[model samples]
Target: MSQPTSRPTTATRVYLARLKGTAVFDPLGDQVGRVHDVVVVMRLKGAPRAVGLVVEVTGKRRVFVPLTRVTSIDAGAVITTGRLNIRRFEQRPTETLVVGELLDRQVTFRDDSGTATVKDVAMEQQRNRDWHVTKLFVRRAARGGLMGRRGEGLVVDIEDVTGLAVNPAHQGATALLATLEDLKPADLADVLHDLPDTRRLEVAAGLPDDRLADVLEELGEDDRVSIVSGLDVERAADVLEAMEPDDAADLVSELPDAKAAELLERMEPEDAKDVRRLLAYEHLTAGGLMTTEPVILPPEATIATALAHARRQDVTPALAAMLFIVRPPLETPTGRLLGVIHLQRALREPPHELIGAILDKDVEHLLPDDDIGKVTRLLATYNLTALPVVDEDRRLLGAVSVDDVLDNLLPDDWRGADEEITDQAMTRTAHG
Candidate 1:
């Protein structure tokens, strides 16, 4: 097989259904594999474009063959450059398997017609030798069922399809969220950042407060700001309140002065107050990095009570790692700091035992003015995930989490590096 002498016109669209399962021939017309799936790379700002084809070779092993290797698309056959690598196919962060992710998926038309199932994707090879998904062939269910056994099929441009068309075999948003639930906040945030804007917002809107806050905290400043700025004041305030005070303050500080003030005013008085206090501190100081919402329990409270509070759905695992035992006034910026109880101690203690009895009194603490260097030194020296901040009067102020410290310590483009690492790890896990 050789390159086709003539190319198809713009009016001629090759449907994915007809191309899939067809024979693939090498340069000398030797059959090597069969086309199993099409691979495309999605862009944040544009329509996805085909990059390669997943071909099932002998021994039923599938491999990815770049579009550059394909010389021509003929009737029921794909002509290639004659060379094929014998390795299994694995998707990258930028790639999506069209058959696994989009074919037979439900898609909404821009004109608001009822949802239709994707029958095939129409691809047109551009002059640049690139294959782009230009249209979609979708089948809509008929109104009546008994007599109308067939559905209406229409070919529409890819632009007309709303949001990402997920695989029909997979559950929708709920399933997506469930699968992503176990991912670290940073990893999940990376996934969200890669998604199309509309889908990103949709996923963000569906997440509960704690989960959303965690994910937002893990995102870069620009990504976090973009996502939050898109929300209405009420929703934005709600998400901020759900986040650790320091992270929330950092995000709000990036907003325009007027917009930040408006959001703060709309937030709950307590939550707003905590964020405002953090905002007042220098960005590199302990006060700026500390969260005002660490798990605080009264000195008289029992282990059971502390454990129960820690177990609350609203409390994040990071925050629940330790409990700060304070005197009379239980809230932060209150009575003298007493001691701290690690979760391990709380769990091993008797249910009714007072937290005061198990307090680890020699706790290393920090003052609001302490710099990031000092904070990091103290945390690393003590091997601590959180360290309490105290006032001149030794009143408990807030606690800085290790995550915040690391955020400041790492290079500015840490998020990009993290995303790459996470993607590679996930790809390995998927293939294995």
Candidate 2:
């Protein structure tokens, strides 16, 4: 089936249009507190644009800032120079949940079966998309009431749920917990990566290819390509387009030349061209590792203007940090590479200043000829999510993200580790 054309963008404005919620963050880069509220200045006409977030710094106080200021988003914390005066932020009725706040508290899921004790909660975000969740990651089963015993293993999916119970003192919020099987393709990819391959593909077939593409980037390279190769060309193309250009390139490069060509033919022309370019390089070089797509803008563009451009492009949350400020002749321009800035840094600063002012001095740069090992080492040491790859002319060709590196390095390893243990158990059971 042909995929729909709606490209999901990581605009806080879009998110605000749907459901508004607290943005949980371990703001210090150490997983801790959740964002209790986000305050945005909507356009007087309609369609609100997120101006800033009301972040509750863990164990400290609440603060707010424009969404444009977000820098680097990671599993641990959101890095930013945007500091808020504790007294200035508009306080909400709700208190932000901290690490110890919900300990031993009751948590509930949309899946009925009732409340369970919170073991620990995990936070996750879509790269380049700033939405966050405070998931009750693990639980001790509820017993004595509507929910049965503690050992039954909490059921994951139910069409709907009627009731929930949690301590008002702790104030943990309930979210619909989708089963590993029931999760959307992207979420399933994360769940599957944590499981075995037999289980991964078995579950993957239930999801649409587009969603599968989102998760594929998260899987080990070997497993990711194996699953894509198993798919028909059309489905493969849909998944590939759904991925970052760097990721799409890595996956496409793995296919037989003819098969890869056929899949590329079905993709959007620009996306197709990007994959082909990366394919031309040895899979380990800076050229091979970089993505052709970067959220680029003219160097003179104001932060407000950049925000508008980002909304139009549907740039994901992760890519927002690497927003490339290029001096345009659009095709290519002269000048050494300007420093890079985080999204948070961009937003919190005065809207009028040129982005060039805040660029990082320690920017990681790579020549197209640089080896893949050099690429990964830079990522490891600098703890960077992305690196810009430029030609000898210093013309930006693309960027390489950490996800792309892991996908290239690991190669289906995540699944096999889980698979082997599962297989051994199955064999023992069969023999017995």
Q: Which candidate has the top score in lDDT?
A: 1
Model 1 lDDT, residue 186, Cα: 80
Write model 2 residue lDDT over 53-119, tens digit each, in one string.
Answer: 5566656676554343455433334444332323335422222332324335555656554665543
Candidate 2 versus truth, CA RMSD in Å, comes to 17.7
Candidate 1, superposed: residue stretches over 4 Å from native? 1-184, 418-432
Write candidate 1's Cα lDDT for 1-432 as tens digits: 121222233434466666778899985689998999888755443556676799999999997776765766754688885646564666643356777887878887777655778877767876644577887777775555653335777777788877554343323554566556557778899999898887787677656445688899888877788888887777677778768788899999988899999999988787888889889999888999898878888888888888876764445566688889888576788789898999987899899998989999999999999888788778878878889999999899999888777677665675666353334433322332
Best by TM-score: 1
Question: Against the hidden true structure, what lDDT does model 2 obtain?
Answer: 0.53
Please give the lDDT score for candidate 1.
0.75
Per-model CA lDDT versus the true structure:
0.75, 0.53
Give per-model TM-scores: 0.55, 0.50
